[model samples]
Target: MSDWIDEIKSQLPAGRVLTDLADRSSYSFDASFGQYIPEAVVQAKDKEEVVHVLKVANRWKVPVYTRGQGTCLSGGPLPVHGGIVLDISQWPREIEVKADDLTVVVSPSVLTARIDEEAAKHGLMYPPDPSSAHVATIGGNLAENSGGPRGLKYGVTKDFVLGLEVVTPEGEVIRTGGGTIKNVTGIDMTKLLVGSEGTLGVITEATLKLVPKPPEVQTLMAVFDEVRLAGQAISKTLTSGVLPSKMEFMDKACIRAVESFYPSGLPTDAEAVVLVELDGHPEALEVEAKLVQDVMEDIGARETKIAQSKEEAQEMWHARKQVSPAIAQIKPTKVSEDATVPRSKIPEMIERLRGIKEKHNVEIVVFGHAGDGNLHPNVLCDQRDQEEMKRVEDAVEAIFEAAIELGGTLSGEHGIGTMKAPFMERELGKVGVSMLKRMKDAWDPNGIMNPGKIFPEEGQKLVLRDE
Candidate 1:
C-alpha cells in the first residue's frame, strides 16, 4: 500500500501527496459520524491530478474516497475502508456563468452559493440552495444531490445539472450530458452520477442550468397551537394552487432553540411555525400571499404574520436558517435524519416523529422543507452517553421505517453514506439492491471507489457513540 502511495506521489506535483499521520487524520472524517484514518491524502487540484490518483488507486486496488467541503451529514466523505482521501476542497474555485444560455460551468471545488451569486449578475439564479451552500462545495452537493428550501419550487441538484466531467473508477475522463437545456441522447449519466455519493466515479467539473431570478418576494409566518396543524397548513397552502417559493416548518423545540440561540422575535410559546415565501411579480405575490394566508387561517393557524418590509422578511428567514445552529447549542451531537414522506403525509410523519421520540426517550427536533415533504427530524443528544446514544439509534431507525412506510424515501437530500446503508435493503428490497450492486461492481471492478458506503456490509448498523 505504501509502495502504491509512493507511486501516486511520483505522478503528482511535489507536496501534493500527504503521508503525514496528522494530515491523514484531518481527512479521516467529515461532518457526519464515524472516522477511519486514510492511508494517504491526495489534495487534487485539477482533472489531471484526479485522473492520476484514480489511475494509481485503481491499479493498486486502493479505495479512493473523493471529498469536497466535508459538510455531508450522511458520512459521504468518511474513509471507512482506510485507503485514500482525495481532498478537492482546496482546488481552485472556477465558475463561468453563461448568462446568454442560462447556464453555468463550474469546477468541482467552487462553493455552491457562489454559482448563484455569479448568476445573479445576469438576472439568473441557481435554485438548488442547500443550507450549507455558502460553505459546501458544488462537487459535494452534486455528490449528495443536496436540496434546500428553494427545492420546494425548483428541484434538487440533479434537476439543475446539465452535464458533468467525471473521472471513471478506471481513471478514464468522460463527459456526460451537454450545455443544452434538453438532451435525450443515450443514457443520462449526468443524473446517474449526481447523487451516487462518489461511488461510481469522481466528478471533476459540471455544467449547471440556471433560471431567471424572481424580481420580488414576500414572506409569511403562520403560528400554530399544535405541530400537526402546522403540517396541515403546508399541505393546504400547496393544494390551494399557490406554490410558494419556499415552505419551511419548525417544531416547538426548534422554535425555542433558535430564539435562545439568536434571540429572534419568533414566538417561542407557539407549538410550531410554518414560514412561507412567495416569489415573482410583486402584484401577483400580493394576491398569492393573501391566498396562502387564508389557507393557514382555515387550517387552524392561531395567527399569520405577513412581513411588510424586506428587513422583516429577512429576519424571518434568518430565524429559519438558524435552526440547525440553534439546535446544536441545545446538545453536543445531533443525529440529523432527512427521512422524507409524501407532501400529504407531513402531518402523519410529524406524529410518527413525536411517538418515536417519546418511545426512545430521545430529544427530537423536527423541521425542514414541509411543502415538498422533506422533513429534517433531528435527534439531539450527547454522544458520550452510551445508553442515550443506543436509544437515539433505535429512534433514528424508527424514523426511517416510518418514512418508508408512508411511501417516502430513506433520504431526501442527504445521501445514504453510512448512517442509512444498513437499511438500504429494507427500502430497495433484495432485487433492487442486487441490481444496484451489479452496476457498482461493473463500474468499479476493484471496488476501490468509496467502499463501505450506500450498500451495507454483512452486518452494518448505525453507531453514533464512540465505542
Candidate 2:
C-alpha cells in the first residue's frame, strides 16, 4: 500500500498529496459515526488530478472514497476500509448559469445553495434545497440524492439533474446525459450515478435543470395540542387539492430544543407545530392559503398563525432548521435517522417512535418534512456509556423495523451508507441485493470505489460503540 501511495504522490502537485499523521487523521471521519483513518489523503483540485489518483488506486486495488465538504449524514464519505481519501472539495468553484437555457453548470466543489441563489437572479429556481445547502457541497448532495422541504411538491436532487461528468472506477472519463434537458439516447446513467452513493464513480461536474420562480408565497403555522393531529393535517392538506411548497413538522421535544438554543418565540406548550408554505400566483395563493388554514382548523388545531411579513416567515423556517444543531447540544453523541413511512402511516410511525424511546430509555427528538412522510428521528445519547449505546443500537434497529413494517423505506432522502447497510437485505430481498451487486460489479470491477458502504459484509451489524 505504501509503495502505490508513493507512486500517486509522485505524479500530483507537491501540495496535493498529504501523508502526515495529522492530515490523514482529519480525513478519517465524516458527519456520521465511526472513524477509520485512511493511509493517505489527496486534495484533487481538478479532474486530471482525480484521474491520476484513481488510476494509481485501481492499480493497487485500493479503495478510494471520494468526498466533498463532508456534510453527508449517511456515512457516505467514511473511509472504513482504509486506503485513499480523494478530497475534491478544493476544486475551483464554478457555477455558470445559462439563463437562456434555464440551466446551470457547476463544478463539484460549489455549495448547493449557490446554485439556487444564482438561478434566483435570473427569475429561475433550483428546486432541491437540502437543509445543509448553505455549507454542504453539491457533490455530496449528488452522491446521496438529497431532498428537502420543497421535495413535497417539486422533486429531489435526482429529478433536477440533467447531466454529469463522471470518472469511472477504472479511471476512465465518461459523460452521462448532456446539456439538453431531454435526452433518451441511451440508459439514464445520470440518474443511476446521482444516488449510487459514490460506489459507481466520482462526479467531477454537473449540469442542473432549473424552473421559473413562483410569483407569490404565503406562510402559515398550525399549533397542535396532539402530535397525531399535526400528522393528520399534513395528509389532509395534500389530499384537499392544495399542494404546499413546503410543509414541515416539529414535535414538542424539537420545539423546546430549538427554543432553548435560539429562543425563536415558538410555543413551548404545544405538543407539535406544523409550518406550511404555499407558492404560486398571488390570487391563487390567497385562495390556497385559506384552504390550508381551514383544513388545519377542521382537524382540531388549537391555533393557526399566518405570517404577515417575509421576516416572520423566514423566522419560522429558521426555527425548523435549528432542530439538528440545537438537539446536538443536548448530548455528546446524536444518532440521526431519516426513517420514512407512507404519509398515511405517519401517525402510527410517530406513535411507534414514542414507544421506542420509552422502551429503550433513550431521548429521541422527532422533526422533518412531514409533507412527504420523511421524519428525522434523532436518538440523543452519550457514547461514553457503553451500556446506554447498546440500548441506543436496539432502538435504532426497532425504528428501522417499524418503518419497513409500515411499507416504507429505511431511508427516505439519505442514502444507504455504512449506517444502514446491514438492513439492506431486510428491505430488499436476496434477489434484489444480488441484482444491485451485479451492476456494481460491472462498473467497479476492481471494487476500489468507496468500499465498505451500501453493501453489508459477512455478519455485519449496527454497533455504535466507542471502542
TM-score of 1: 0.98
For model 2, where is the 10-residue window of minimal lDDT? 9-18
lDDT of each: 0.92, 0.92
Which portions of model 1 show Cα errors greater than 4 Å?
none
Clashes of each: 0, 0
lDDT of 1 by residue, 1-467 (tens): 48888888887876878888899888888888988999999999998989989999999999999999888999999999899999999899999999889999999999998999999999999999898999999999999999999999988899999999999999999999989999999978888888999999999999999999999999999999998788778877788888898999999999999989998888889999999999999999999999999999998999999999999999999999899899999899998899999998988989998899889999999999998999999999999899999999999999999999999999999989999999999999999999999999999999999999999998889888787
Candidate 2 scores a C-alpha RMSD against the true structure in Å of 1.2
User: Model 2, stretches more than 4 Å misplaced?
Assistant: none
Q: Candidate 1, residue 29: CA error in Å?
A: 1.0
* Candidate with the greatest TM-score versus the true structure: 1
What is the C-alpha local distance difference test score of candidate 1?
0.92
